[model samples]
Target: MQLLKDQERSQRAIKALIITPISLFIMISGFLLLKDNHFSQVATTLFAIVWGTVSVVSFFYSLNLIVQVFPLKYYNKIIPFVFVGPAILILGWYLFIPTLRSLYLSFLNRNSTAFVGLENYKYVFTDRTMLISFRNTILWLLFGTLFSVFFGLLAALLAERSSIEKIGKTFVFLPMAISMVGAGVIWKFMYAYKPAGANQTGLFNALMVAFGKDPQNWIGTAPMNNFFLIAIFVWLQTGFALVVLSAALKGVPNEIEEAARIDGASEFAVLMRIIIPSIAGSILTVATTILLAALKTFDIVFSMTNGLYGTEVLASQQYKQMFKFLNYGRGSAIAIIILLAVSPVIYYNLKEFNKREVF
Candidate 1:
């Protein structure tokens, strides 16, 4: 019996040694072939897809066969690393490496030729436009997050009792289907300004003209215009907030809510003292999500007003500094600042998610 077991283990080890290298070679060869355009482009694409698919299938199969050579205890320990190693490597290569490079570039000059320490950060803090951008970003974080969560909570509360909950959710979630740029374009038309005598193409201006007020440039005002842009973001994000918070709300034990009502607690009291606390994690999740979005807002500002009219945010300023003005140092500094601002909220969000998972 001992001799038979030894012979079986040796045979398995030999088979694994023979198959693993062949599987690896096939996978590499398939990947190389997939990158080539020597044949008709469509035919090459199709062939590569098949080749890659088969290679991956065979590779995994051979990997499992190789794992059989290991004892059960060793296989269990090694299997997790085998599955998770590629993702860790990819994240390090793409995210961690690039982030370090950006941080290093922040101390370099515009052409990245000379080292100019602290100058970019100084410019970011003291520049007039950048100051306005900081103020506007605060406003975006404040009002955008507030109104979005507020309206989302309101919608969730209302829809929970409504017969058409699914329909209501669908309509509210429709705006999320549109990209930020598309939403900006849609709202841009709504806020378009035309002179009093000519036809008012913009919906808001036309309504104003019908009410006998003169046509106004909605996107040309200073702080008020900033709020207008924030409104657009709120409109776009409220649905997401609603979806998440509503799910959280649904998770609240109905017995607790009923008991509160039975104890003579008002609906408002129940909501404030019981319901809100129950789903506080989800609320924080949505708030932090919107907060990050507001901080790094660029697309709507870029597409709608191009950050003119005191509407700049950190992301827009960074983009203009880097691409338009060719101020790479300043751009990198702004990016670092944005990352710093976002990191705390990200940490809190992840912590909340992890806590929720544990519970």
Candidate 2:
């Protein structure tokens, strides 16, 4: 039995080595052929689709064959890896490799020809525009996230008790369907400024005119303009928060609320003590998700203010450094900074998700 088992193991190992290389060669060759420019666009697309489908099926079939050759005792141990291993490798290739390359580039000069040590990082911390971006990003993180979660929670609660729940939610959620740039354009018209004497086209300016006040440049006003930009983020993200929190609210048991009320707890107390706590996990999840969005906000600032009027955020600064100014080092440094800033929140979010068994 032992000699037979050894022979089986040798056979399986040889088969595995042979099958792996052949499968990879075929997949890679097919991919190259599909990518060749000799093919027309339509032919390339059709070939790519067919090639991808065939490659996936063939790879899985080969993987299953390899797994089956292994003894039954090892089948369970290897099966999970057989399926998940490809994804892990793909992620490492795509995400991890690029990240390391960026880190290396961050230490180099603008054109990545020479080493700059920490100079780029110092510029990121001390530059005047970068300072403004940091301040604005903080405002976005605090106010944008706060208002989105607050209003979303309020809307969810109100909608839960209202007769026109669907209609109200539909209206409130409509802004989420619009792209961030589109929203900025729409709101730009709403915030459009004209000379005090000219007819106000903007809704806010028109309101000011109706009240006999001066028409203000909403996007051009410093400090206060930051809040207006933050408002756009809130409008875009609140619907997402509302939908998530609304589902969480439904998951709370009605029995707990009734019991608290029967024990003479007021509505406010019951809500604060019972309902909110019950769905606290979901709320944290929503808040963290929005927090990430706020941290990475670029489109609204880009479209509306172009980072002008003191509305610069981290992402906008990164864009300016990388694309506009072509400073790879500074851009990579700023990107790493943003990554560090959001990593802790992401960790916490994933931890909460794990506690809830969301995976």
Candidate 3:
């Protein structure tokens, strides 16, 4: 009986190996034929649906068949790989392939029809508008990340001690419920300006009018407008930092803080030296996350100022290059530069995540 079972498993494994490739080839050929217009539109759609369904079923069937053929001890060891392999492949196909293509396109000309080497990169670094965009991007990263994290830390600390903790946090986090574009629209109203003698529809302008001052075009001001734009992002991200850092703070042992207090440490010292140090990792994590968000901020700026009046950042500039100016090379180069700038932060963040998982 044992010899028969072994022979049957071996034969089944051989059959699976043979059938898997054949099914895959058939699936690919069917799709290719459909793409070649060998079928009507309705038929083509049906064929695609059938092909996808069969492909998934056949893949798992083959996987299970192979697993059955393996000895039980080896099967247990290899099962994790069988499930994880497909996801890894999908992730690579979606992520790494496009990144490589973008990098290749960055070295090409405007239409991506000819090689331009580093010309696009040089323009990104030296062009007047590009330089301003770079400066604005740095400003956004610094101010947006700094203020968001600061306010978040403050909110987390204050909320933890508040009688109405949930209600207070819910209100502070209310802005987060608005989409970035929606928040931009709401703030646009807040920052809206009318002539000094008009009805003063904007909230800020109305306040100024009530206080006997003129209405100002807040977003039309050049460098100051950039900071005004950064404020919108800070408002949006503060809640995210608050939530993450608050969770981290909760994880810190109360015994340490109480002991510090008993040793004659002031409240300021306890927070500065004890609580902050205990949750330093979480702080760095939240800061890096907000930094990345600031680096890639587009919708808020695009919706509000549309990169006008010297409020452009790298992402907005890239959008103008690719869509408005139709300059693929310069756009891709800017994108690559942005990617390179954020890659280190992303790497460090991931490493910290791994460390947290390990410990």
* Candidate 1 lDDT by residue in tens digits, 1-359: 87876787789888878888888888887667666656798988788778878777777677777776777798898877766776798899998897788899899999899999999999999999999989999999999999999999999999999999999999998999999999999999999997779999999999999999999989998879988898899999999999999999989999999999999999999999999999887888889999999998899999999998889988999999999999888899999999899999988887876876853
How well does model 1 score by local distance difference test? 0.90
Using TM-score, give the best candidate's number. Answer: 1
TM-score of each: 0.89, 0.88, 0.85
| Candidate 3 per-residue C-alpha lDDT over 228-335 given as tens digits, one digit per residue, 9 for 90 to 100 | 888999899999999998898899899999999999999999999989999999899899999999999998889999999998899999999999999999999999
Minimal lDDT window, size 10, model 3: 56-65
Cα displacement (angstroms), candidate 3, residue 58, comes to 8.1
1 against 2, candidate with superior lDDT: 2
RMSD of each: 2.8, 3.2, 4.3
Off by over 4 Å in 3: 4-62, 73-77
Deviation in angstroms for 203 in model 2?
2.6
Q: Candidate 1: worst 10 consecutive residues by lDDT?
A: 30-39
Candidate 1, RMSD to the unseen true structure: 2.8
lDDT of 3 at 60: 73
Error of 2 at 179 (Å): 2.2
